[model samples]
Target: MKNTLPIALSNRHVHLSEEHIKILFGEGHELNKTKDLSQPGQYACEEKIDVVGPKNTLKGVRVLGPARKNTQIEVSLADGFTLGVVPPVRDSGDLAGSPGAKLVGPKGEVQITEGIIAAARHIHMHTADAEDFGVNDKDRVKVRVGGERGLIFENVLVRVHPEYALEMHVDVDEGNAAGVKNGDMVELIK
Candidate 1:
């Protein structure tokens, strides 16, 4: 496992706050976990919402489980272009100054002030994994993917935590461009 990490392709998804979840799915309604994600304690919910943008609407956008402090919508650059919102490539939860969109649920609709973003590519590493890779939290590094469309990814942020598994996450666009799929191995450029 020398400088190797598995890749996970992230599609467009939404994370709702408790208040927003209540407003969207109705009072006392909790998210139904359909499947567990790579991250610990996070899951994909059975519920989905419609994201209405200035230009178009994305229907059936899956909502991630485990309510967050703020509601954030993560989209790919292509999705952003389709939605007519230029969401910045930000880390998860770094939604300040990002674009906002209208989220329509079965119960009601929520107009977020600012939460949409095109998430930056990053790696989640456990403390032991970071120690093995010689990386610290928030450290940016380059990653090499080998394939017919092989390319190097730069400025990939490292997030270190005890619960985090060692994996690299990229948007759908990035994965497609690199000709990589989920579970593909990538090398950390030291």
Candidate 2:
């Protein structure tokens, strides 16, 4: 049986470590929530920063919080080209031997050693939804999106957690190519 899941298009953004947050913002600055994201306990902060790459700089890049163990930058392939960095497609929090960039905050700037990545397209499903979809955590599957720009995306990672809401996350390039928008339903083909 095939299952359909809602899609969420993720833009280029950074998740900062607490130390980096203090350095970039201030000694005791907390990320002010701009809005709650689909994921549990995650949000877009009011703060924005500029990320400088080898060939270009990306301005107004939103910061997503609460803080991560290590800082990581997620971008699409098109975004990678714009920044002149060939980012590896990695799952979130998997930043061993990735690329790096300079992050410019309003108060300070810091150089990240290695964290930039093209986040892998994945589906976050709670236990109940996982059971419904007949999948488990870390299972790889294919997804079919129907439209004028319809396509079948392979190796879509399945992330299962009780706290995670059911949503498929893809970068801007993937979404645009598939003609998908937020709230669009995509089918999971085993």
Total backbone collisions for each predicted model: 0, 0
**Candidate 1 global TM-score:** 0.99
Candidate 1 positional error at 20, Å: 0.6
What digit string (tens of lDDT, one per residue) describes model 2 on residues 1-190? Answer: 4499899999999999998898889899989998999999999999998999999999999999999999999999888898889999999999999889999998899999899999999999999999999999999999999999999999999999999999999999999889999999999998
The residue ranges of model 1 lying beyond 4 angstroms of the native Cα positions read none
RMSD (Å) per prediction: 0.8, 0.9
lDDT (Cα, tens digit) per residue for candidate 1, span 1-190: 3698999999999999999999999999999999999999999999999999999999999999899999999999999999999999999999999989999999999899899999999999999999999989999999999989999999999999999988999999999999999999999996
Candidate 2 residues lying further than 4 Å off, grouped into runs, are: none
- lDDT of candidate 1 vs native? 0.95
Local distance difference test, each candidate? 0.95, 0.94
